[model samples]
Target chain A: MESNQNENKLYILFFLVLSVILLFLSSQMSWLRNYISYVYTNTSHDQVVNGRQVKNYFTLFSEIIEIKNENEKLRDENSTLKSQLDTISFLIEENTQLKKSERFLAKKSKYSEVNMFMGEGLEIGYIDLGSDNGVKKGGVVQYGQYYVGFIDSLDRSSGTVKLPYNRSSFIQVSVIKPTNIEGLNTDQLKRLVSEKTKSKAVAIGKGDWVSVENISTDKGVADGDFVITNDPKIGSYLVLGRIKDLDRDPASSSITSSIEISVNYYDLNRYIIEIQ
Target chain B: MSEVIITIFGIFLMPILSPFFYGFLGINVTALFSLLVLRYSHNLWVYITIFILSLLNDVTFHLLFGSTFISIYVSYIFDIIIKRVIPNETRTLDLIFTTISFFLFYVSLEIFMNLSSGSGFRAFENFQELASSLLYSFIMSSVLLLISMFRTYFSGGTGHKIIKL
Candidate 1:
């Protein structure tokens, strides 16, 4: 028995040493982790591992069908609107109002599911697409034309997206006067963003939403105005969100407002984006 | 049957569960489960199971490899020390030892992963985050352990009596 105990100790020691070596090796071998992650991703299937219950939205088949119908209706409406706007060939100079920006064309794109969210405010999210998919850092992530986030970091097969609401996210944006975009169709708004805008304010991420500050009162910035990313690279084609919580203080020279990210992109299963 | 349950939840389910634990919940349920196993069994397979779980954990979360594995071993070392000093026979002693082991586990994990981080590593650089995470997990796991122990006590024995096999 004493001999067996010693033998057991040696076996444990050997196993531990082997594990430590393998651990070091795993860091160097990225594909190993990627392969394993793929296995886990398939198994978890959007299960909330947070130990907290996530409400199942599709408990009933009717709910799923209803959502599908709503989606179909939106797609149809979008197509009609596109056709209605196609007659007016867009005339605005696309670069007139933009800051001197990164001038790369987004020739490639991909779709990814959000793996999970992390960080202090739970604003940082990891998506399944990674460097492997030609996803570069600073890649703009969008849901169609609406700006959502930027790629913060990446592993072999996954990338972290810094949501616009993350404290670390600050995007340069121009506040479009409410009148500029009020009745304009998607194409018209896209054109309007390219022209010189009334107010240029820095959108500072403020947890669940962003706050655009330092806009002069004369700029006619209102609660319903459009906030679009005015970055030097990747011009203002994508809408950041819309202005809300319009704070106008008489004592202050500038006005501040919160930009409401209209859609809860978090609820979307897949993120499809054209990244430059 | 209990071994089967532990094998399923402790090894298979933990990799799926750990990211949620480590991400915002600030706990390592894998470590918690491993602690329970170590608290009861010195079987070689227990260590191997934890090692596999940690590996799967790092893979799933895209964390630094072996970070979780090494951290658990560090906790195991603490457990060994405490096992000697504290008679873990009573319920209170058991809880006390487990808590201390968990605290050391997180500390080791934080320090180990961050040090191995090519960036500078000061063990205490992010002390507040670590403490808050520890507090959160500790309270939660303590409640869980307490409930299990109570239920088992009523069932005529300990929650996990040392299985000699």
Candidate 2:
């Protein structure tokens, strides 16, 4: 009985010590983990494993059915977390766009939403605004700050908006990769982008989209560069569209690029503005 | 030559084979290696060498650092307890203790691994698998232990020692 008691006491002490150490190690103590890793450089080849670049040989060789099932469960959980993260990122992006739209609205107080009657050839839009409503002949019809087209002709109560894709439309534009000149503000960047026509080209109508013409191959302009309106009559420094693709002609020493406008007409752009 | 082979197998091939055995046969060669090594060897360097081997095995197994190290510690501690508790050297007790030490080593290792993998107290959730693995480990270690004895007798070692009381 006395010997049995000693054995039980030893068992208790052993369990107590083991439990404490196990718990201590199990805790996510970064400092302790880092210390152990520093002492032992071969903590893991975790980069390759975690990056999913290589097969984790241990998992391949020794993972039992139960462990595989657990991994599947964790993968499902990871997918759910990834979707939740995407939702949050989308909300953040929408919030940023909303803020930018708000600033855009504040800057242009002379914006009016009008109905667009599509021309017979689907080339131009006849708007319900005219000179009587402060509508001018040369001002742009825009969606927020995105250049859609300009007022070609205006009468007592209506006007014609020449769409970017209209065959008769021709406008001078500048193209530049969006970059922040560290110390410059948006106004300063706007002045610089409006004045520097390094990517000077004419946007000509192509019935479906606008194509850049006469751009020199040495202009340093690439696809996806922002196309800004340089025609001061239509309002200077307004973003027209992004350069979709650039096709260079070696003989002519010129490049051709198509612009991908943000707004899709006849869908979400029924209501637009004549922003001066 | 045989001794060198067994050492190499236990130190090197056993780690790789252990995974194959565990995945299919459910035999724990790692536990078996610990039992045989501690049972036979007394050299400090031998223990240190096995400890290093255990470290390599942990990396190969992708287990948390020091998992196989703790398994070695389990065997060492059990050896101490048995030597201290038993008053006489009995082969039966030696076999029983070795098996028991293997059980403890696996238990500690599984618990540590499960905890590290975010399983928490659900370590033994696959109770049936764990039980069978322990059984296979016991059988393998016991068979190897008996084979080593037979080898000892054939080689004219201490296995054939006899005396009239």
TM-score of 2: 0.37
TM-score of each: 0.43, 0.37
- lDDT of model 2, residue A206: 88
Clashing pairs in 2: none
Chain B, TM-score, each prediction? 0.74, 0.73
lDDT for predicted candidate 2 compared with the true structure? 0.66
- Candidate 2's DockQ: 0.04
Worst 10 residues of 1 chain B by lDDT: B156-165
Model 1 / residue A220 / CA error / Å? 70
- Kindly report which residue pairs in candidate 1 clash with one another: A101-A232, A101-A233, A102-A233
Tens-digit per-residue lDDT, A1-276, candidate 1: 898678667756876787678766866778877777777765543444433333232245677898999999999999988976753322122122111111212334333333334445647877777777677787777654567788888886788888888888888888776553333434565568766477888888877778888888987777878887778655435677888998989999999889888546544434443432
Give the runs in model 2 whose Cα sits over 4 Å from its true position. Answer: A1-102, A105-109, A120-122, A179-189, A192-198, A270-276, B1-165
| DockQ of each candidate, alpha-carbon based | 0.17, 0.04
| lDDT tens per residue, model 2, B1-165 | 244655676665654555555554456566666656655654444444465556555545545656776766776688678888994746676667766777777777777677667788444568785786468656765766675666566666864333212
